[model samples]
Target: MHLLEGVAAILVSVCIYAWAYGKHHGPGAPGWAKGQLFASLISVLLVALFPVGAGFVALGLTEAMTPASWAGLVALAVLPVAIWKAVPRLARRA
Candidate 1:
């Protein structure tokens, strides 16, 4: 379903962003922090659309054009800021 795929996409993107953040921001990775955020955001946007692609194929394009898809689009649009705030806290826990 679109909901499930959307949720999965968001979760995976956050995890990827978190990992990239932690990696580039680590102590030994000096001067790399400046570009890490952009790299992480680009990575998330490029990678997270896979599940939605599957949803389109699984449900058919016509069927997929529903409220859930709209919500997914909004969620994807908000994802960068969410990950920006959340990933730091999550990294601190680890």
Candidate 2:
């Protein structure tokens, strides 16, 4: 079940990321927007690791992760949104 869930998360995340990239990363997009899009892609990719790791741990291939690790993963998942909002403002001031 964990493995299946992890697979689903990966599939969904990748599909969404790919759609967003295609929509927002056209030639006319600003450098800041492209940068943010890539940043969000990285953030979401890292976020997807949590489920994969969980699946691994469930299968006893690895030990459980620390609470801080889990918290950090959650933080990374949210970081993209923060970057998305902050980068434009910073670019304008530059």
Candidate 3:
């Protein structure tokens, strides 16, 4: 189960990273592009450990030991920048 999650996270992060790479180090939104690259890298690590939250819960452990929570936490931390940059293009398409 953990392996599957790790693989999925790796694939998702890699694909997004590949797409985001085009924006990074380019004549584009520097902060937004950098965030995507950074978020993707962090997400790969976080997502793999996301299930750690469930483990903590099962073991009556605190959230402090739950690495899974950081997956969404990190995503939330970076989401605004990505959305801020993408909304314009997304809105134009819609």
| Candidate topping TM-score | 1
- Which segments of candidate 3 are over 4 A away from where they belong? 25-31, 34-94
Q: What C-alpha lDDT do the candidate models reach, one value each?
A: 0.61, 0.52, 0.47
Candidate 2 error regions (>4 Å): 28-32, 37-47, 50-94
User: Residue by residue across 1-94, what tens digits does model 1's lDDT show?
Assistant: 4653655565665666666667666666546555866676657685656556446435533464677666766665676777677777755523
Q: Considering TM-score, where higher is better, how would the candidates rank from best to worst?
A: 1, 2, 3
Please tell me which predicted candidate would have the highest lDDT against the true structure: 1
lDDT of 3: 0.47
Task: Give per-residue lDDT, candidate 2, residue 87.
Answer: 49
Kindly list the per-residue Cα lDDT of model 3 for residues 1-94, writing each as its tens digit. 3323333343344444445455554565358656765767656655654455334333332235245545544554565565557544432311
**Which digits, one per residue and each the tens of the lDDT, describe model 2 over residues 1-94?**
3333444454445444554455455556556656776678657775866567456435532335566446545544665575566445433422
TM-score winner, 2 or 3? 2
Tell me the TM-score of each prediction against the true structure: 0.42, 0.36, 0.30
Could you tell me which residue pairs clash in candidate 3? 50-68
